[model samples]
Target: MLPASASQLLNPTDVGREFLRLLPIALFVIVFGIAFGLASVQAGLTDWQAILMSVTVFAGASQFATLELWGQHVSLLPLVAVVFAINARHILMGAALYPMLRELPAGRRYGILFLLTDANWAVASQDYQNGRQNLSVILGGGLVLWLAWVAGTVFGVTFGGLVANPEQYGLDMVLGCFLLSMVLGGKRSPRVLLIWTVAGLSAVAAYWWLPPHTHVIVGALAGGVLGYCWKERRHGG
Candidate 1:
């Protein structure tokens, strides 16, 4: 039998509320998306192509990274490798959520995974750790973010140069600040702190020594291994 949390239905009201809650962050997403659209155009993609990529891929960093590699004669293998390496963290993220996700119907499960991004995933995973089951944030917040990205792309392609310097507004730091806040909000035990320290050091080491875009996965795996080896003591164990 499925756990009670697994069978929990997503409330429409909760979804809408979460969407509104994330609206502020979505505005920042718009600015970054605009930048991406402008860059894509400069990289030789048509407006439609830029918008299509935003709609289909929905991954800002990877999209931007691809822009660096854009040329008349694109190398297919290199492109695929870069995309996979950059977004490989999604594999671990999905695996971390699989226990809860397995409770939903297969279609719903995969549908939710499609919407998973850093922000919504942070909220969902943090809430899950806090004993809350809130997949609505993943779905609703993701919808808002997706729409913001697509709309921003359209605006940039149609009226170019509107946002000349997104960095001036500190737009790039928004998501990082938000994710840090989520991590700080979680219950911090000595064990968890140690795990985080190991992850942080591992990431720094990988950033200096490993291939490009491998630090995140390396840090995550390091933390996972430590957690596995040193399980938290239960209340009565």
Candidate 2:
């Protein structure tokens, strides 16, 4: 009683390929998540609470941003808005699938979106556009990232602070470096670069001018809109 796509998610080749391809990034994400967990502890979160958030939310920057705002005594409404806004990128990422998955049933398309993340989106988007990817591949790879992030957070929360001179590992910059490298690679077009620059600047500005978390929402919306608009203009759609 499973759909074709759901059955595809269990394909061994897809899972194996993703497992091999993600090995390097897996370790990196783990270390990065650990750093976040450690940060959560120092920010006054209990050990179990930090790990739980990582497992349940599985969003690092958003989690950190929310915690930072909370530490400053920001109201819960704004905090929720900010995190939701930050997560809006997933919508844009899922939109990238329209061209590739237009023929799939609605439920399957939504299922894919539910598992998408910035990292998996980057990898799977490329594969999808290239006409070589399937639901199996995306799901296989996404599960890896999900597990890596969760394990990493738990590892860091449990033992990171105890490590003497954790700075020596330089794990703090993992996510930034990952995004920077990805953006630099994919920002090949002038329009893409313009949107990226605008979004980055807008987020920073929002941080300073708007209410708490507004910047995150604003940046995501601006970037997504710019990308969509640019694509429309270029494609005459």
Cα lDDT tens digits, model 1, 1-237, are 347553354767888988998899999999888888898999999999999999999999999999988887999998999999999999998898887787788888898788889988898899989988788888889899999989889887777699978888787899999999999999899999999999999999999999999999999999999988896797432
Question: What are the models' TM-scores?
Answer: 0.95, 0.72
On residues 1-237, what C-alpha lDDT tens digit does candidate 2 reach at each position? Answer: 233453454457877787667667777777777778888888888888888887778776788787776464659887787788777666666766666555566776676565567676676666654445555545666777778888878888888765434458776666567766656654267777688788989999999998665675688678878877776456577
User: What is the alpha-carbon lDDT of model 1 when measured against the actual structure?
Assistant: 0.89
How many angstroms is residue 50 displaced in model 2 relative to the true structure, after the best TM-score fit? Answer: 2.3
Q: Once model 2 is optimally superposed onto the true structure by TM-score, how far is the C-alpha of residue 96 displaced, in angstroms?
A: 2.2
Best by lDDT: 1
lDDT of model 1 at position 77: 93
